[model samples]
Target: MIKPLSMIIFGQDAEQRSLTRMQLISGGKVNVVAESSDYAHGLDLVKRYNPDSALLITNGKSEASLDLAKQLAKEHPSTVIVCTGTNCLTETVIKFFRAGASEFLMQPPSQAEMKEVLEKIVAARATADQNKQGEAVIACYSYRGGSGSTTLSVNLAATLAHTFEKPTTIVDLNLQQGTAPIFLGVKPVYSIADVAHNQDRLDAQLLKSFHTPVSDNLYCLASPLKVEEADDVEPSHIELLLSLLRGQFAYVIVDCQHFIDATTVAALQQADTILLVTLLDMASIYTTKRTLEIFHKMGLGDDKVRIVVNRYVKDPDVPLDKVEQVFGHRIHLMLADDYRAALSALNLGSPLVSSQPKSPLVKQYIELAHKITGREATPKKGWKGGFSFFGK
Candidate 1:
């Protein structure tokens, strides 16, 4: 049986506040670990219980609701913040949702409607476990520069590791400024340059000597971090090193440089899922089209490559279907427009999944993991990775 989750609710409204808590408790949506009428006092309850879900159930218009959700997302990191009010306005609801409200319930929802929302949260949570168990790998790269490829790679890698609690490793093959270590807060004594210099001695013991552990199950291959030493490493050296690594881990993520070089090709050949990321602009979309054409020309199957549109906003500047028409391929993944929040998470050295799990952008990456691995990823109560079957 699944245990109930911790939840926090904030409001000055009396009746509406109690009603929201009652519904969650009745349906087993949460354990109701903490409850407080005082907004300031609620922060202690939140920190004490460490709820996975929170609701701001104030009576009328209150800017405090908006401020609370933002703080919870920043401070709690893993908590899912939500807002519900009787006098909810369209603009206010939209603003709160944009402020990271996971689910919004209007005043006086029927028991069934409330049930449905809670169920969706539960179902999504259930899949989170299977995603941790399956053969999940997300290889992120770009067709051109400044397309936010490395940003995606760094965050997704850290997300898979810390958010899902899976064993994750990122191989930084960007000979110049391999950004994984910097984003992940890892430091390495040696790199692909050193790995190549001693490929003859590359084994579990030898490889362990050169790598840096970012978290319990997460590791990073810091690039040389200096341009002068990059020329010493070759594509073949990276290929050999990664081939050995693939056998040791469940997911092998390679942040391949934006090049059609021998190294990138070798990594692609070994990759189970390749993310061909591009922005929505004309030039970036054209690069994606060219990549598809080149892949076809090289006799490579399209099944392995996933076209992802990064930094996608619901704007009329370019229809997503038209972008597909240009590439003549459907975009499998469309990351949201939370580039600022995503960057803040990256800048703080914590991945988006941990910093903002319920953010639309994090949800996209979570969904992509489910599709790539063909397993559902719902949020889990205990362990947070590919599958719960491991370590038994």
Candidate 2:
């Protein structure tokens, strides 16, 4: 089946706009959403129409055209961009490509060239949609509070997005006292209850509406604002909600409450990796051992259950070797204690990975992301300085 292509034309020349519109229409599969006279207006058109592709005219010495293309590509990576101009110089084509334009056409493009470009865009979109359908789900749980499971969940999701550049989401399943949203500094207008209420009519767009953006690539599905609201969420709702989210995001990190309930059980069953967070304390260790036994009875193996030691130090009340022997499972990940950094992030309503990018905590999360993604984590130049909190 032939897919329809939505396009917006950008050019100052009336004659050029007319020619391009005529050529696009002649292709019989393109729909012109809007026309712009300059790069600024073209950006406004893109924001309004959200077409499948934006056709930019880089005539003369319009360096601003390349800037606009780069901005659109970075901000809206899903949109395809094509550039056309009288200057088909190899240097000009290279610039357009670097600016994120997928295809370039000469002035008054032939019908064959237009058709070929549209087909390429459509085929690429189809393949991307197919590949992004299944997402990895990571669930973080602890038998005791203050084990830092929620903090791990939030930073792990952010690291997966910032480091791996994949679309990631964190779900707060601790309904009553969930702090995932607070950590991200987002007061969501809608919560998971809203999704449960509208489950019958839920779709990708509707599910996404409940997600509040934590960053360009990370989002959060916050817990219920009112504790009582969690009562309305059913275990089946959790299963369905995760299924829907898996289709939309590349990674879904779930922060579960301390106690295991119907909702948490459902989440654990769906998780690709169940992170059991503990501390170097007797209480935390004892609880973790019991939790692992429960997982065993539930038919989960060592591969599925990953033991994480949070707030670990070289010397502790309970030694690492002793803890491992007691649990009978090697710790898969260890996060160093940074009380000052953790306190600042909690107080500032931002994640440590974003707030204290230079903090060693951020590297721990990055390493965890690498472990989960099976990808290598490389440090950037001056990365030791860390990143500013989204320019905060």
Candidate 3:
């Protein structure tokens, strides 16, 4: 059985406050956590109890009632505020609701009316809890520049957005010379530099203005258009920008720069899962092993680091076991090598998953998305690439 809705009540009229408390307690669904005659004391009680609902009762004309309600709503969005007063005119009620009152009641509320109001608040809480979920930060990086990190980042983002139909944004953390926007064929007017500049006023709506929309669910916050603009974005700016984006987006895919600079380190620290993309070649493999050591030093656990072998082919030269032994972690995902198909998509300024939907390379990209999101994406019918049969 679910516990009762915890509540705090504040009223000027002691008789009215006592009556309301009696009604709420009788219902057996509302737990009166705290009660106060002073509005200021009530605010303190609210902070202490962290109740689900706050009942603010206005006796005659206490301006503090509305002020307290507004502050509570702003500070604790989870708490529902119900305003009840004798001067509850339609215009006054509208004003109270605008001040963040979930429900407004006349001075003398009957037992049934109080019960109904509490029921409504309880129901709304349940719905909100069901919808609330933590945002995912998928940061893709590579020790070597040519390991196809950006390719994997963009495609993984597109696949997550298209398959799950959730709001996704790709942050081009390759502040200088980042080509994530180029792969999507998007020219963003506002980039990460703008976010850094406007960090003081950065909110969901303001951040939305900086993104270049690719589709209904997918957006891109491109890198600085000018190389010098990248200098303006500091590690602190990257951390604040990503923290704001995480609240608004269901998935924030960070296309990280190859270098282990301050900005890149900031991204790695915030990521829910870091996709370490690498190729099977000697140079890429050796660099990745070194990178893993650095990750260990930084206290990044193996669970948070997912090694993705890009352009993978099961060649005898670099066996799978040897690669895992070097990295000290299993390869979480392997993307197939289809040079012609991949190059065509890159040239066309589109993600491979959308450009070549039926290709096996796209299928593997979808599977990689599944591995990250734990959601299976339906594979579309299409021509397998030339190397699909021979590819891993």
Best by TM-score: 3
Candidates' lDDT values, in order? 0.69, 0.80, 0.80
Q: Compose the digit string of candidate 2's lDDT tens values, residues 1-392.
A: 23356678888787888888988888667767567786864565565445678998878536878888998998767779999999898998999899899999988788888889988988986776456543488999999988899989887887787777779999999998888877777768889999889876666788899998877678999999788999999887887787667667899999999998899988997687889999877777888899999988876778878998898888866677887899999999889899899878766666777668788888888888777777765533221111233433
TM-score of each: 0.61, 0.63, 0.67
Q: Give the winner by lDDT: 1 or 2.
A: 2
Instruction: Tell me each candidate's RMSD, in Å, in order.
Output: 21.0, 14.0, 11.8
lDDT of 2 at 240: 70
Q: Would you list the rank order by TM-score, best first?
A: 3, 2, 1
Cα error, residue 200 of model 1, in Å, equals 0.9
Q: Cα deviation of 389 in candidate 1 (Å)?
A: 37
Candidate no. 1 TM-score: 0.61
Once superposed on the true structure, which residue ranges of model 3 sit more than 4 Å away at CA? 1-135, 379-392
| Model 1: per-residue Cα lDDT at residue 209 | 65
**Tens-place lDDT digits, model 3, residues 73-153:** 787777899988888778888888888898888877887788889889889867864464434788999988888999888
lDDT of 1: 0.69
